[model samples]
Target: MALSQLEVTGAEVYATQVGDRLTQRGHQVFYVSDTLSCPHKGQHFRLLFNKRSLPRRVWHVLYLIYLILRYKIQLVHAHSRASGWSSYVACKLTNTPMVTSVHGRQPVHRSRKKFHALGYHAVAVCENIAQQIIRDLGVPREQVSVVRNGVDSQQFSPLPAANNDKPIIQIIGRLTGPKGELVYQLLKQCIDLNTNKVQVVSGSHVDKRFAEFEDKVEFCGYSDNIRSTIAQADLIIGAGRVAMEALLCKKPVFAVGEAKALGYISLDNLPAALASNFGDVADDGKTELDIDYSNLAEQLASFGEQHQLSEQLVAAIKAEYDLDAVCQKLLETYQSAYVYTKQQEVPIIMYHRVTQDDSQKGAYGTYVTLERLEEHFQTIKRMGLSPITFSELAEIGLEHRFNHGKRYIILTFDDGYQDNFDLLLPLLKKYQFKAVIYAVTGTDHNRWDVEHPTKPDQRFELMSHQTMREIDQSGYVEIGGHTLNHPKLAELSEAEQQQEIEQNKAELESLLGRELTTFAYPYGNHNQQTKQLAKQAGYTFTVATDSGPIGMHQDLQQIRRIVMFPSTTKFGLWRKIKGNYTYKKASKQARQIDE
Candidate 1:
């Protein structure tokens, strides 16, 4: 995906590690952490161990023991047998359960014999591997578990693919770790087999972790339009995240994750991620590896079945891992941790601008008089609901604090005009309510040819929004990146897209001396690339202008917002909020009903 800027949605996966899942299981989970890292990527990690100068492997063991003793760890979930042995011994001494997931690899793992002695339970990504755990590894049937990796079907899906003969093979993954290792080998095989005619596009990180792979392959390190790439693919060969994406596109996918065979796992064994599997090309007798090039070329010939296969695969993939089902399972896991966790009832009401005068008017926002501001404050004093800040909303989003029954609302204004301070500040002071103004911070607002000047500016403030360049620290405001160049991010290249998202963060941090926590999509449009870039850029939430009022339950990204027009009435506001305005209607009419 070519995502130049990020969007807000549950689109990005952050360091919500094992214990968090266990907490979802409704178990009494204890979280211990002393350090935190950036939140933009799929996995969020803390310093489970950090030794400044020590080789990471050596210190990793020492830190493991330290954490086990410090926290009195009750269970250990390891991805490899070597890690399992370490966990098993510590858990045995601690009388803890060592439930480990294979996470698909074998190169550096300890022997199955050693793993057996560790009293560890094995979890595999697919059933075939679960059987292997029971049969090949001698783990008991009950001790092995299978959980097919899931995809957000709503986020990634195939387009009506084109019947083009220039076959493109799409592969997305990190340049290092299992993903990098897999790509390294697979690309080499393609190279040696002399299949240069097939276009290969790969997406992943090329940071210090996977930098070595740069020399061996033409890497498309990051993207916003991941779905587009998949749609272009004649076939997709990947592991982990990319494989799941391919299935979403309903493309024929080939995957490998088992380190035992260079992570060469089969797509058929995967969840109904594809309409049908394009089985691996078996090697001819003359080739060293067990795959054939001629057969692969013949297999690639099936690229013409684009839409036909996409339609077929959609049902299969949806049946396996739709969001509703996945969220339900995750809900069970969360409920297990705390059986009483209920639907959070704190309704998040949003407001745009507030004016001290009742009659001063603007389009799409409320204008309150000083009397109305005081009346609202008096109501807060009498107390049925409380006002919360943007940061607090973020904590709720991260699930750090759950709102029990408190009625609450958040104030946000778009277009960061000077009137925010002029008209709203006095009223805000009167009520003592905290309001967040989402500033445009760019010339978009001030760039009036001395023409059509009064059209957009309302009583507001301004912040840095110049395509996310260096932040200006005029402490009166909080700054964030909208993008270096605010093109719809899904339209950029992988490298250019990554630069658009990351460079702004760097620029802003350098200017503001703090990391930016908020982002608003330039025009409220984003794709897979934008979501990933936002994650990589470490935004807590990305706001959109096109959506409806953001409910508390909405994913942090994909957060909805409703803008009232100057022509709106209160009755219509409530109705729009109730979600009565249909998306289908909005799509057809090319309009969103304000009411």
Candidate 2:
């Protein structure tokens, strides 16, 4: 389900693109808005009401509840505050997940701060908006994701410009609010109407002040094909999505938005422009306008001659704003929201080595005795908790599996020790439980740890290729990747990290004759870059220690896990599973204090 209050806006375009893509991906989509201006290939429902009316607000909530129940909507994505408040109520009543996209800076008020209506998750179109909501609206930082407005690169690709004596400067925006006033100011004060071919592409009526330059300015109203309109211009004047779309079309943009003016987008000012969402926001987070029309006009004229966008800049924009990548991120957000709504936690138990004797114990205490392992397995069985692999969890979404009301836990053994194949596989088979073994494919020994100067020489043999293949073919165990040499991922350069992560996954998949879906960070140490490398390496789920920033199931790339130490008893295991999130929070806070 998609909800929007505006007829045609950047938020509506985002909804349309996401809805159409989701439809193509074999999912049914529904749109509820005041106007059916969205061209999404989905069922549209009318939601017309005065936002300030008390009775109408109640009616809107009830109507949304009816739509949700009638369509069995799995999720509701609200695009604006008017839709967000009522949808929040409807989703809560219907026990459905909701995601709210914050497109612009929100007004700060005591009432809004008290009831943010951010739903389970809030997506901001830029980092500036994300921070604003967290700081001003009292939305939790963890619940907010920065997902920019995606553009269909193929549809908005570059077009060859036609030569003309005078450059056509097309200004694109809704002719209302600050944008309309900006247009009026530009025409009256900044733009040279006689020297430049000026055109205004807006859906609203032109300001009467523009009557002085009637023949000089052309009005191209509400174009259905914005790309065609964009292609006809020699230069573009807009902000936010308009600036982004023009850049994608390889046209120079004079970045002027609702709040401020970034005279022209160039490599030098691109970072600041992007941070403020191409001038839609200001440095101080105020709504008052900040553009000097005379200075802006002078800069705009000189900018056209000074700036020629490089190929790298265009490629960077395409990659960052790619439609498919944005949709994937949104889908992940949806999944997180759905999981959050379920209010159930899956405890992922992490193990490293299995030992039979006290002599084999290492200083790190990362191993458990074989007998104690079997005892833990017995406790799991006694608790009637089904052990599942990460691959299985990926195949069956968290919501679908948890909806059955059956208890599920994940048992993961990291650094595929030969003892696992020699001893652990039999225990898994005996209990009929599933487990994942993350193997470091490059070496067959614990060289990374053994070679350390200060660490104990706790040398252990890793599983061989044949051993891994046999166990992977067994129904009880799934094989995963744990980097090549088990280096601290945060310490490695990006190229080295990619080589370690991707090469490990590729080798394991080749050896197992199937794709590997899980990865365990070596030493449970990683950073943002390393996490991205893991994702690029094709791992569906990556494991980290309890120190991960987000909740366990919130971030698939860096899932938190329960470390099963050698001293962990049956009671300890039970306590950890029963209160996994509580334990994780305390542990994280404790670690912070220790640090």
Candidate 3:
């Protein structure tokens, strides 16, 4: 595990436990942090400096490269954001796979957008953190997994119920935030009690509020052996890792943290408590808590005097969050990360017509203004992405032959319009780019416009055979079949689908004087039957208008493409290029439309 800081935090504790267990199981484990955190046998440890200094950060990256080369590191698991950032760069430089375990909500800044390309598969410690990484950090939900913190039930097991004599309530972890204030107030509420109570506070980052109660509470500043400290308490008031650990110790816990409280851990609310990450709830979803001091004190005293830990609760924790189970998940996540990193991601951008204006507003989404086309080209260039034709993608994907050392986007112009030849051809030539134009072979005009009820008067002209042939001859363009009359393939019979698909391929090949091997479904509409018909039609690959980035293992028949709208700006184009554009709403609406 690569951790930036070696402090005894939940993330570090998790790393330590995982490493110790893996090493015990005869796996070669290595630790890289500012300080060593291994608890068991000896293992390889490498020192990394603080991330605040630029030179030190670079050194850490270089050291990671060295470690990968020297130790042949198979996978890297980073525990903190600082370490994750540097490790991500190092892994990218060395072509190594990395997975990050975000223990808390990391700040989402604009600069971090560039790292999205690495596609660092994430293991968020909780569901809320998992959601935050997806919603806030722009990570794909498919790429992030939620593996909540697990506790060592063996190490923190419950003591016999006979020791419940005097109430000994403890508060653990960094004494800050609303949890800290709650702890302070709870301690004050119990200071004058005459029930022979003992209160213990254990953690680092002890706040100055403790100075006022120097003689009131027993402060165990910080201890590496927190499980032992937790075992000595009858009840615990904490949240997050502390709450989980205390529960493992068979102590009744009031799950309170950061302005939220679950009051007490019981069988009925156990599932919701775990889903809320053991009461360290997301700010927007925190449960309002009004802790009545006298009542809470009475409950704690009663628990110490009579209540025993529920066997059902202990059994659930062991079944769901056992250390062994969590370790196995980490191993599986690492293997997945390795494969995910190796898969080449290609984000296809689908364009239609490049027109001077949007005077014809019926299909405005398909028409990009000339200026926007130029902006898209420039944005693609600045992002260091080269344009490739569909044939090029097929060669790389199906054959695994050609190796282009740079990122690529398949620039496809669907429903080849005459404006594509006049307006888009120059931009393609200007950028020295390659593109595919899917042309409707049977008609010179969009006949559906005149026949359809939606746009009865909007009969936009499609590119003629002569124009498509000219474009194909340009060496920078490849012609693909877009059906004979641009009918929805799914709505047609199998024979009709084959006619629309196979006949269109034959017509395009006859016009271009070359074999047509690539196809695009008209209106971005297709089903399994439509795809199989395209395969039987002899086309090597086909594309759909699904909004997403393409991967190497993606279906050749149903390639995903992101639509480039007329309203797309330079920044929007950048987001599209990064495959981070927020187009879920647009994508859904697009699927509803024929095109």
Sort by TM-score, best first: what order? 2, 3, 1
Tens-place lDDT per residue, model 2, 330-352, is 87787667655754367788998
Clashes of each: 50, 0, 0
lDDT of each: 0.47, 0.82, 0.73
What would the TM-score be for candidate 2 when compared with the true structure?
0.72
lDDT of 2 at 69: 81
Model 1 bad stretches (over 4 Å) = 1-62, 68-75, 105-111, 117-120, 157-167, 173-218, 222-234, 252-289, 305-307, 310-312, 322-595
Query: TM per model?
Result: 0.40, 0.72, 0.54
Candidate 3 stretches greater than 4 Å from native: 42-50, 113-119, 162-165, 176-182, 189-207, 283-306, 343-595
* Model 3: how far residue 380 lies from native, Å: 42
What C-alpha RMSD separates each model from the true structure? 19.7, 6.4, 14.1
lDDT of 1: 0.47
Which lDDT tens digits does candidate 3 get at residues 1-595?
Answer: 8887644567777888888887765466777888764364445565665655888888888888998888877678888777777888889898788888887665667976546532368887777777776777688888888887867888878764325465566777666655666777777774343454445455556678777766656777777787767666666777788877777777787776654566678888787677667766563533345556677666555554545669888778667678888987876666445435654346677887777877754543568888878988888898888888867766554322212245777789988888889988998999998999899877788776567776564667887778888889998898999998889999999999999998888888888888886889877898899989998888887888863223323467887777788898999878776643323434456678856
